[model samples]
Target: MGKSIRKISWVAFIASIFSFSWALGPSPLVFSSGNQKELWDELLKYKLWGRDALDFNNSNIHFTTVEGYAGTKKDFTLRNGNHIVNGHFVVGESFITDTGPHTFGDGYVRIGGDLVVTENAKNNTTFNDYVCVEGKEANPNNGVFKKGTPTLGSCPGFFPPLENDLDIPVLDLNKLSGTELADFNGGRTEHVNNGVLVIDGLPDNPEESRLKDIYIGELNINNNSTVLIHQNSSNNITRVFVNKFIYSDTEWDIKVSFDGETAIDDSTYAGTLLFYFHNGFTIPAGDRTLHGTYISNGDMILKDHLRMAGQLLSTSITIDADFNSEHFRYVPFDPPLVDPTAFANYILQEGIEGPQLINFELDRPAVIDVDLKYWFEVPTEEDVANYGEGLINANDLASGYPTSETNAKEVFFKKGQSKPTEEQTIVIIDDEFVEEFEILVLCVQIGVGASLPNGTTHQCFDLYIADDDIYLVPEVNEEFDFSVYENSEPKTVVGKVKATHEKNDSLTYAIVDGNELGTFSIDSNGQILVEKKENLDFESDLKQFVLVVEVSTIFNKKATTQVTINVLDVNEKPVFKKGADVVVDENSGEYFEEEWATERFSGSNELNNGKGQNENHPERPGEPQTFKFIVKYTDVR
Candidate 1:
């Protein structure tokens, strides 16, 4: 049991066209020491800095410094559209304008706390780079720190604290297991075991409460609740750990959405949302504009108009209304690096190479070469021979692949054959020479076999291949026999159901089972109207009603059919069955002997059975009625 080796340069990829399965495992926090100013002061001491306006990688938090404040209120302006802030700028009672006489952007401003100036404020503050007045000295006469130089003290910290710490793993809801509590109640959980999860109203089954990495212990969210995150894209990230507080009364009705694209446009950064609050984070009144990131360990009571583009860490931040940094834009906080379960089981375990082991210190026996690259985007030979039969219209595999490279058969091993031999590592790719691309980038390159000694080293692994199309399910066009005419008037169309799809007009009709017998209604162009003509009664409804309908498509693909309908039964106008209180008391008037009857209706009595030779009235049985008798009323003397 003596075999240890380590040498990998890099080249990893894993995109065999969509396939996901990662039962929660990374990100428990692991960054021992890469020291970037001590990891930016330990991410601003756990405020986790990484704001967004794009640039989501090298742990973003831009703003090397920017301070501007001009006076003489002429429309108090500080437009700045120049934007660039890597960190360091504190405006207290805000007022920095500029519409002429420039100099306000290009960065540099340090004012730790207190720069108040409100009596309807003014302006006269400018700084293209350099204006320091932290706390310890220099007040600069209430407000006048133009274009640079104003130094004094404080302002050189910007995030730094957890060098080698590790303790955020507590999630033992009684030691889980029951398939991990049914995969955390089947939302595939991310974290949340403590307690309080109140999202107030609406969720007996909102697609099973669509969740995602939500570690809770207290997370109310009232004010007409809403917390959807149905993401099928946008890199899918939705963490919401709240170890203590996250109240919410009316920030425009405690909302948080993604999928329905909650407003603010441009796919609102496609929703990456993270709201970690270890202690306090309330939302008193209304107004909000969130893209993502809002870590608060304590104190963040924002009221009224609270616009946040992203990243707003807090230990204390109370804005009662209007704090508009032009709609609050300070995005930065890149979170997503939690690999240490032996490097996530050597890159998501599957085959088992070297079965796990790495001590390093080899003086001889060393040969670990593992290469696996599967990048796709070339399918058009009739979509690789009609891949698996139907629905094929691909093209969107993350949008970058078409240089041409296809080599799917290679695997070798020596030095005790570091585990190969399953036909030297099976690798098949012959879907009729596959092509129709949209994304399938899987790169895995781990090399080291030139007689070791750091001679051959490589490491690369990337994965993203999603564009599996195959949807063709709309058909609807089977049983349909209409008759109508029971008072027919409501909408009247009745028959026209024809659904067939290859996305033809995108389909979309419905009546699914008579619609509670509201009498039918299909329409998205599948016609079939006649909704409720008093529920169409052929003798109190149901002469033979069936309906069903269905037919969807906009990608939801569905189909159903069955119409029936047969309500025909009209004709009814001959009635004289007595009882207006008949009384031959008009001076003994005759022909008043009570029972003045003439019945013949109940599905239109067979027709024709007269007694005066000039008659033809059996409830208008085929129309030929001619049995007359006139009478006028108003002789009550």
Candidate 2:
């Protein structure tokens, strides 16, 4: 039966006013009020009739009344009434209150302004067409109509359509986290990469019987539902797992980048076009950081050890393969031509380090052995004809078959089982040897020296040596001579040597000294000296002399020492004679100085006016010619 539409009941108010008895009994009540005052009056009277059975039944009846600004205080004293309205119920803001716990028929009763009970009101469609039914067109007048009319009444033959009752608790996908969404045994449809799948929602305490099917469309997990991947269902029979997949329509292959977002399970995978994967997917090395793009999709099984270096944008990548044995035939078929040797070479040469490659071995001999088939490349027909068509037989692939040919070998891998080793040894070459050399030692000192009349003068030395062999002494030596009065110009010496035979070579020089005033040699046995002139001048005090001599060898090795020549003090002055033999004390200081002075005192008597002129005053003219006393002496120090 079509559920009848009803209004919000006023009996709730009736019960509130009459607390002690069941005045309106437990009958379905329908009430209407044009305004509030009349409604309250009728409710009061309904409560007053609660003392008797007849009154209770009579109150079970329904009633409705409307009054405008007439201000007529009419009271509705129904000895027995089911529903009643006694006041002017204004529209728009009128309200109904629930006085107590009341049970009514499934029929809905509404009191709001143009309200529809079932349809979700988040987006209002009823209010879009709401209009007031004036006094002449309300209820008994136009409210009742023939079947098929806009205001159609219920008809037995003309069946009234009814909507299915659905009271689904909406799940705020945004509110759930990845872990919280693990087991979703619900009646709602699930979202998969393909499209969607229907699922059942479990009862609060679900058993097999309580699992009800539900269909959902266009489902999306809320940000709060951070579960990128999760398995749903507690039972072992059926399990629902959800994973995130990126849908790309671009022509060129696109890679996914994960900034910081994560998927369920601590699994990592790379994604590509062919295989859907989870944690074992490959990703290009350089990509932007963002979530949502994953190289692979699907479930992943992690074994002993796994090392992935790419960006694991999404949940994980699954690697799943199974064999079909029922289709096997004994027909003599050429095994797929393959280069297992080359494959093995590739594995050993290009394989990534770590547990990237898995190997399986069994102790007992199996009934059959399984091997992968390979194809080799050929550039020409002659090459194919020369080498001939290389074919591998089933016997070559699987072993353990009866040698007698009675028993055939059936080779197949168990579901979810991986091949031990692909008959390939993988070796990753890492560190490389780069030839490098280091310099043991380096020193540079270039020297050039010349002998002069005054002394041997040499310029700053420049010598450098380097080699991977024995150390070589300087091939060039700088010498100096000074034995004449003419000024000698400075000479420079620069040279270097290289190591020989020995890996590391160093430069060492023999120590030498200067004994000749100006003649010197850089060799080990040489000596430098500054000769004293035939006639030398000295005055006042003792005069000290100093001279610098330098000695150097190969590799710029050098040593400097100061020589001294003291000239005795004598009362003499330097006299330069033209065209005469000139001499120079090469080791003496360039310039010289001496001190000489004389002290004298005189005494004299002046006139009586200047009697006894100050003896302390110095002799002056005229005024007194104050030459008191005089003494003189010549001294030199």
Candidate 3:
């Protein structure tokens, strides 16, 4: 019954949030021993965590079901980020998209197994970040987000072997007064009232400090009697552990949250009440308003016309569904689930990003996972295989400023894996970046169950990181060959000198060489250009030139590179003046015929004589008188 209580919470929270029934509550109460008491308070760490979580606490493991849910934020800091679970979350009911779009995020969800949603969930869900399931998405067509699924791990949770142990501290209901019974609060819950086993909340224990559960018997709050769970500014939770069952017949609801900040001030808050039933629980028939996390070790049946902002965790959960009938709103644990570690009171750290390493020493070889807001409990070897390796969730996406950059992944240790060479395992975080201010990072859950000698089952921590960015030296290189016509327009850009600089430095450029012909130039932006295009000739003595440019940053770091410039040849068209008219006569083997001839033209030239006398086409006449000219002449000077 001990571990069963803890495991019960695992499946309990995921199976059903609010229901009033108990298939196992009474049996555990009768035979509840110290063993059963051990396994207490392991509410489905995330989405779900039980042998039969979200499985409707069925007779077997086949059918897991969920009717409604919510979680939509970007930061996992205050329970506003991704709500990741290592187990399977199943929704058995099928509702249409219009009455749908169940919100399970701030960011998104990353789980190991398949997230099977009933058919209706396909088009109705809104995911800020993709709901990544390593296994399979039964209705893959659902939700906007399907990115960032983890291939890291499966949640390792201890299943409640027997059931919740309700026989602890022997609650003796005989010596209790009406005021103490009606309004239960502090004190021990071990007393034997005459013969009947009733609770009086007064069994002496040396360490009667901090918070303890108020044990009450079978309670029926009918006739619209509202149960009030007290809450103060400093304390926002109250645990009520019952041995039998709790039933509410009227529309009045029970406050059932252990993390509600304003439960007492405003009835609207998830009240500081954790109503735990060792057997079963219910608000039979119809009830509209409820606030808190309802937990059970037995079966739970949900009625109609209900509106709640609480959580449901039970061994077996069943909700009566009707079209347009049920509504469940999600509000992060008001004060969220913090560390339950012995020394959770001492964990606030500060440091710089460096070659720093954090080492973990394991007592035995088992799976260990770093709970970066993604894991509620340490994940097992089985958990890793399902979700491979990826970012589990984001605290702020680390982009509250720019807002949408994902850069955090949940880490895990392999099960039965070999021991480390040094200690057991080591993790290092080294980032070089420039930041305006220090950043505070939060990893809400951190522990490896009993795997570590001094480890607790659960813990949380915060760390501040200082800015440490480094600037490197500047690098410059040669701007390669570029071609330009023999005559290009002055001030035309031929090529550009380029280089790399750090620290947002400004670089200036100047031509160090290339003036051998005084025809090349460079601008401040490193543009290579020509000053006098006419001076650059492919056939001239200066057919090619080398330009050496220098570039320096604001820090005065200098570098020079050689840029080769080649002048390209542009072909000039041949000029022709009306060649001396050629005359030819027919039969001019001896007859006169226009023939190509070389003659002095005052300049070097070659000409073709037109209108060759018709030697082939004996006689032909045309009004336009288009003539064919054939020229084969020698050079003339």
Candidate 4:
């Protein structure tokens, strides 16, 4: 690519650091052409032509026509009527020979005006080259900038004069609406007296659309008029050229605003806005505003001679001194895309919010929302209706389309109806309930080429989540168990249960019963043992009972057993009977048998004395004295 022809850095630095060339009024133009090489030969003949020539290979410029010396060229001056410099114009050495008092500046160079050569004793060649300058006029009308073909040391003389009879194209300003003008085709134009000049009409040709894409070239407004440009096309405006009146003592100015309004302060030009007049031209000195609107996806190329009085708020600015001899470049401004995570957090950090739409759908209708904070993407119904479903992806979520404020949420996808084979499914569960909830996640396998009894072709298994862990159902007890008796009391009983599904966790145990006869204790080893308590009632007549043992894992699982206790009986008390004698039969007084009737151990009164234990002394009849006896019974241990 050709190196972009911008103003020389040194020239710009000089122009910025010091003031020069004011004597020439404004900018002056001298056209030259003809197979570039031939034009350079003619230009080199001038005295005021620049002494420096570029060293580029296959060079087009042979000499700098702006340089010259005084006292070596003819003493020339300007006339009042129509004047033209048909050939190379330059000055000789001594810079000033036949002119009035002159001002010399650090970074300034003066050209134009008829050449004045000095006569000296040494150099005899009085006239070195030709030079022309506009006559000093009391009132210099704004000059005209004309375009023509190339020529050698001058503009093409054969070309027709500029179409001066042209009329300003007119349009109904009211017809243009919404800050946009269209349907133009270059057939109509709105003449702006003041304020902004916005050219939104369609180009005269679609090919021009390429030139206007994302940019509209700088507009040349009528005297005292301003232009504000923006574009939705592809081409970016590289520069702007203006033609206006040249005042010997005054300056030219302009301004620009990016989005309209008062975006920038006025800018000033050191020269006049005119292009003709080889000797008398002016560079603006005051300031003007540059109001422009930036394209979302384009850059700008600002030309030179445009100065900012206030702020240069823009993406960038560029200047060129050559192309069409203008100094203004403007282009569309584009904003940056934000990071998805940061964008999401910016939208959802404060509160529980619903899905947010991030981008727009093109072609088919679609809208997508993204929670970048959690890396979540959601598609709306509009998107599904237009783009089918699930068309929004991570990339789209990151774009945040439509507007920067997150209001525009629409976009399109190519094949929204197609299922994505690579996406992984996730099951969201509340972490807080993991301990108590018995969640059964069924793993359903759909067989490829099989049919079930019910005509379905699928199989499923249940997985139970218990004890803060996952397990398959239908587990069995597989641990070895040994039960030994210590003095007729139960000892340790050990075992382990195997789960159907292999899960990573440890077994836990709890004893469900202990007070009842059948209740037992289970240790951490999954062991069960009966507790022994002394002095427990063991009588058969007393109420008999048993112990019940229940064991299970941490989640209320249980395997049970019964423990029995035998009740036995022993003697508790004893009783004795008292002997009754024959005293009651005394009245009958039956004759006593031989030997004084000693009493048959039944202790009859006839053989007993007053003592409770009867020991017979004599037998007698009649008076019967009561004899008392006691019956006693004792409890045995």
Per-residue lDDT of 275 in model 3: 59
Which 10-residue span in candidate 1 carries the lowest summed lDDT?
1-10
Q: For each candidate, what is the lDDT?
A: 0.39, 0.22, 0.39, 0.26
Query: Per-prediction TM-score, please?
Result: 0.24, 0.15, 0.31, 0.19
On residues 258-293, what C-alpha lDDT tens digit does candidate 3 reach at each position?
223222222234223455665656556665455555
Tell me the tens digit of each residue's lDDT in model 2 across 1-637.
Answer: 0111111122331232211101111011112223333332222211011110111112222212211100111111212112233222212211111111111221212122221212121111111111221112112221212222222222122211121110111233444444434433233333434222223323334332322222222233222122222112221111122233332221112211122133311111111101112223222222112111122222222211122211211122211111111111110000111111222221211113432221222222211222221111111344324432221112112233222213322223221223333332212222221111111111111011001111111111111111112122332223322232212223322111122212222334332333333332232333322233332224314243344444343324444444443445443332322322222233343332111122111212233321222332244433433233221222243
Q: For model 2, what is the error of residue 42's alpha carbon versus the real structure, in angstroms, after optimal superposition?
A: 91
Which number leads on TM-score? 3
Candidate 4: what lDDT? 0.26
Clashes of each: 63, 99, 66, 93
Displacement of the residue 347 alpha carbon in candidate 1, Å: 27
Off by over 4 Å in 4: 1-100, 107-186, 200-210, 213-224, 231-235, 238-257, 261-637
Model 4 vs truth, CA RMSD? 35.9
lDDT of 1 by residue, 1-637 (tens): 0011111111222222222212222243223335333333233222122111111111111232221111110111233232223223333222233222223455444443334332222333334456554443223443444544456555545311112231222234455445434543443322223321223212234343322555445444544444443333323345555555534465433223433444323223322455665555656656645656566555555554555545555444443433345444333332211111222222222123222221121222212222222222334546535443211223322233322345433333333233333332112222322222122222222221211111111122222221122145876667778889877898889788877765353677778675685777777888888877877756663677887888876545587888887888776454665444432232232342222345333221222221112333456565533333332222111
Residue 260, candidate 3: alpha-carbon lDDT: 34
Ranking of candidates on TM-score, top first: 3, 1, 4, 2
Q: Give me the runs in candidate 3 sitting further than 4 Å from their true place.
A: 1-128, 132-208, 230-237, 246-248, 256-263, 266-272, 285-292, 305-310, 321-637
Candidate 2: what lDDT?
A: 0.22
Deviation in angstroms for 253 in model 3?
A: 2.7
